[model samples]
Target: MADTQRTSERINFVHQDEIWKAHVKVEKDSAEVWPRKWGFLTEAYKEFERDSVKLKEVKVTPSHHLATRPLTPPEKYTNVGPSPPVPQTTQALIGWRSAHSRLQLEQHGQVHHGRRSFLKVLGWPRDACS
Candidate 1:
């Protein structure tokens, strides 16, 4: 009951803030700062990414790239190469089964395999999902 009330209050507060924001006048300074803010954020993200342990510098191999002899994109901007392949439904099912098996290892209850894991993968609580 308390949790429900808190959720409702949080939702109400969010809606109220949205309503106020919609009516509030935009300042020229706020518009001007957007590009500067994004530039700073992009630079910071690049710096952090460079320093991250997971980031590895790769030397490009000569054979790695395809020469654009025939289907070469114009000197100007153009969509290059092939689009990504569509994923099969079984791929998702496999992921769900794996995650559910992991969850089953943690808990006492019997996991309903794909059904329970489908909810887990979709970010739904097991009890609420049912």
Candidate 2:
């Protein structure tokens, strides 16, 4: 009985192995004629190559402002007589403050709406316009 059971299990294993091998063969044959598979792969590779070349061309060049050489002060510095004091109008001051506030809010990921922090403070209600 033990030998008979072993022989049956071996046969089942062989059958499963044969089925797997046949499946692999079928996949290999089908893949050979897959529409534009190779062409698509080659085109994808070419696109990657093109992008790589473009990226290389766009690599950041060092700017003069960031150069390692020591910066020398300007040769001539003239101080013109005290300039006349400029008057600040309320509206201009308010506009400047608003602009500054907006910049600060933007830095903190908050939207600015010209004196309306109601919508911004409440996590910017979903329906709010961008």
Candidate 3:
């Protein structure tokens, strides 16, 4: 009769195409530092709780607060479909087209040194800057 006790440990491997692997293993000790470590963490946590309570008790006026509340446009401008396409958007479109042309020219060993673009907005001269 042969002994059937297996001496080898089972192979533990991650099943994934990823490269990074990590794990932690701590040996048990009769007198462990874990208690002391936990005590220190608990003391720090209590201190943080006290500080948080102090923070909650603090009352600062909005004017004294460091963070500025962003200024959003009034409710009417929130929905954009009502307005027609503005001149700024048209200029932006033209700019994108010119940039594409420039890229193509550069690829073909050509240099474009002229001004990026010129936007001429044709509108009736305002009598008093409308």
TM-score to true structure, per model: 0.19, 0.32, 0.27
Report the C-alpha displacement of residue 9, candidate 3, in angstroms: 20
Candidate 2 global TM-score = 0.32
How many steric overlaps does candidate 2 have?
Answer: 0
Candidates in descending TM-score order: 2, 3, 1
Which whole-number lDDT from 0 to 100 does residue 32 have in model 3? Answer: 75
Best candidate, TM-score-wise?
2
User: Model 2, which residues run further than 4 Å from truth?
Assistant: 1-10, 35-38, 61-130
Global lDDT of model 3 = 0.55
For candidate 2, give the lDDT.
0.69
Clashing pairs in 1: none
- Candidates 1 and 3, the one with greater TM-score: 3
